[model samples]
Target: MFKRVLIANRGEIAVRIIRACRNLGISPVAVYSEVDAKALHVRLADEAVLLGPPAPGESYLDIERLIDAAKQTGCEAVHPGYGFLAERAAFARAVIEAGLTWVGPPPEVIDLLGDKVRSRIAMEKAGVPVTPGFSTEEPDMETFEREAVKIGFPLLIKAAAGGGGKGMRVVNELKGVREAVEGAMREAQGAFGDSRVFIEKWVQKPRHVEFQIFADTHGNIVHLFERECSIQRRHQKVVEETPSVAVTPELRKQMGDAAVATARASGYVNAGTVEFLLDKDGQFYFLEVNTRIQVEHPVTEEVVGVDLVAEQFRIAAGEKLSWTQEELSQRGHAIEARIYAEDPAGGFLPAAGPLLYLEEPRGPGIRVDSGVVQGVDVPIHYDPIMAKVIAYGPDRETATARMIKALEHYVALGVPTTASFLRDVLASKPFRDGETQTDFIELHFKEWKGETDQDRQIALVAAAILPNGVKTLAQNGGEQQSWRQPTPWETLGSWRIGGNS
Candidate 1:
């Protein structure tokens, strides 16, 4: 086991890795930008190193700086939590070349699977079902146009290098093909520094499901089953649950086997996710491979009763998988809701402000993983995700109900959040009936305005109870004071039960 490991990321994921390291008696080192000097992850780690400016290019994404930080801290391994350089093959190679263990798949595997176009070809060759797409050695407009026509309309122009909806476009008709392709290429260049794009037949109303796979240096591999991540907006998942309502016992085995085969073909090791798109007819097609721990991994952990991060440590240490396929079984239902500091009413745009107050929900079967704390300023330099709230129960219904309650109790003032929207989605008919698909948000909440009388009343009550004097409200024909801030003694009234005020 390594004595120390450096977490080369920030936000909730960094805090998550730190806790895991502490449990295993490994000293965790954290790297922070100037803006994150006081971040929760920095405070939790055994030691902290300052990266440069807050910009990702200067701090989190700088491979040389990250390697240097780990070496300077005497870390034996580097854990690149989910974002930033987590999936960057170059970063992983750099860590290996620096004589430090990388807590992820081999760099060669990452390089093979990171390119969406290349991965598709590999999966097809390995007999794994993949969506129909076109990829050539030298891509040109003439080739793209011919392939687009053959693939039919309602196709997607996706970035060959990156994920997260960037460098992606939906082309619904022939007339828009040229503009869409050009725009996607430009966006892809700016986001991933790669100008490559590919065309694929878009499967309409498909469910996004992924299998959690683990492998070791001894060639042992097993899948932890599937996660239904169909609840999404803007091509990004907001809610994920285990034991997908759509997957049956037989289908689970088939998908799990396919996922394992794909991993083996890529010479993969450590933790990774094999994502697939399941159509209405029950046919599943390989989408892509996330060569790192997924953000929605907690749901899998809650159901399988396994610590994935701990498994990552063991695998990186050259230990064989601790459990066999038959030993792992899904015990209960789990759901995860991502809480982002974004305004749902304003098109879910990221909001930046001080966390005036924060009250995370707490209870049995409820877990809150957060990076921000009260009084911390949420800068506009990075992802807006503030926390993740996960709920587990004996069944899907119970889990869904518990999640709704948890979201209702979660509070973060001075900045709008997606809490209310998440609560509504959990309670919606489609989600309750398990009719989730990639178009869930668009189909149900395309023009959603997160306004309600109950919400207004709560805001009004909160304002009236503040220490400052209450503002006056205009009545039918005149202005009147709805209420006034009360002092401790004033609230006691003229008399008490056994004593005078």
Candidate 2:
């Protein structure tokens, strides 16, 4: 085991990695930008190094600075926790060349799988089912137009080198193919530094399911079941659950087999997610591989009783997988709701302000993986995700009920969040019936105004309690005297409001 490991990321994932390192008796080092000097992850690590300014290019994305920090901290390994440089192949190579263990798959595998076109070809050769589409190393306007006709209308023009909805366009007809391709390529180049694009047939009303697969240098590999990530907005997952209503026992076995095959075909090691789109007809097609620990991995952990981050450490230390395919089984249903610092009503616009008041739901089944605290400033320089709340139960109904209650109790004032929105989603009839699809939000919540009667009641409670002192003023008509109340600052008087405080 490594004496120390450096977390080359920030926010909740960094804090998560630190905890795992501590559990393994390894000293954890944290790297942060200037704005994150007082962040929770920084406070949790045994040691921390300042990278640079708030800009990601100068800070978290700087491979050289990250490598230097790891070496200077005497860390034997570097763990890129999910975002920033997690999927960047060059960063992994840099760490390996620096004589430090990289807690992920080989750089060559990352590079190969990063290219959507190349990965599709590889999966096809490995006998995994792939979506019908046209892919080429060199594509032009004429070729794209021709391919669009063959692939039919309502196809996706996607970036070859990136996901997360970046550089992606859905075209309904051939007239929009050229413009969409040009737009997708430009956005792809800007986001991923690669202009390559590909075309794929769009499966209507598909459920997004992904399998958790892990491997080791000892040549042992297994899939840890699947996560249902169909509830999404703008191609990003909002709520994720395990034991999908769409996946039966036989279907889970099929998808799990394909997921493991994907890992074996790519020579993939460590933890990764193989995503698939399950059509209404009970068929599944490969989507892409996320070459890192996922944001919703806790759902799988909660059900499978595994610490995935710790397993990553063991794999990097040249240990075999602790469990085999036969030994791994999901004991219960788990659902995870991502809490972001964004306004769901205001078109999900990212919000930043002081976390004046905060409270996390706690119970037998609730788990909150949070990074922000009360009285801290929510910065706008990075992803607006503040935390993730996961709930588990013996069955889906119980899990759903727990999740709804947990969301109802979660409180964060001074900045808008998706808690209420997620609660509404979970309580809706369609969600309860498990009719979720990739376009679930658009189909059901296209007009979500966000402020319900409950919100108004909470506002009234705040107004009543926040008036520390009042003065009366007489009107000309001598009506009951009007009252002027003190401000929030005067009422609170530097007292922090939170579960911890």
lDDT of each: 0.88, 0.89
Clashing pairs in 1: none
Candidate 1 per-residue lDDT, tens place, 127-218, comes to 99999888765778888888899999899999899688888899998888899989999998988888899998999889999999999999
The per-prediction CA RMSD against the true structure, in angstroms, equals: 9.2, 7.0
TM-score of each: 0.92, 0.92
Question: What's the lDDT for residue 209 in model 1?
Answer: 96
For residue 294, model 1's alpha carbon misses the true position, in angstroms, by 0.3
Clash tally, candidates in order: 0, 0
lDDT of 2 at 24: 96
Look at candidate 2 and tell me the lDDT of residue 4.
91
Candidate 2, residues 1-501, lDDT tens digits: the string is 999999999988998889899999998888888777667787777777889899999999999999999987778999998878899999999999999999999999999998999999999999999999998888889999998899998999999997888899999999999999999999999889999999999999999999999999989999999999999876889999998999999999899999999999999999999999999999999999999999999999999999999999999999999999999998889999999999998888889876756899999899999998765567899988899999999999999999999999999977799999999999999999999999999999989998768678878887886643321222221322112342342232112223123
The alpha-carbon deviation from the true structure for residue 425 of candidate 2, after best TM-score superposition, in angstroms, is 0.3
Total colliding residue pairs, candidate 1:
0
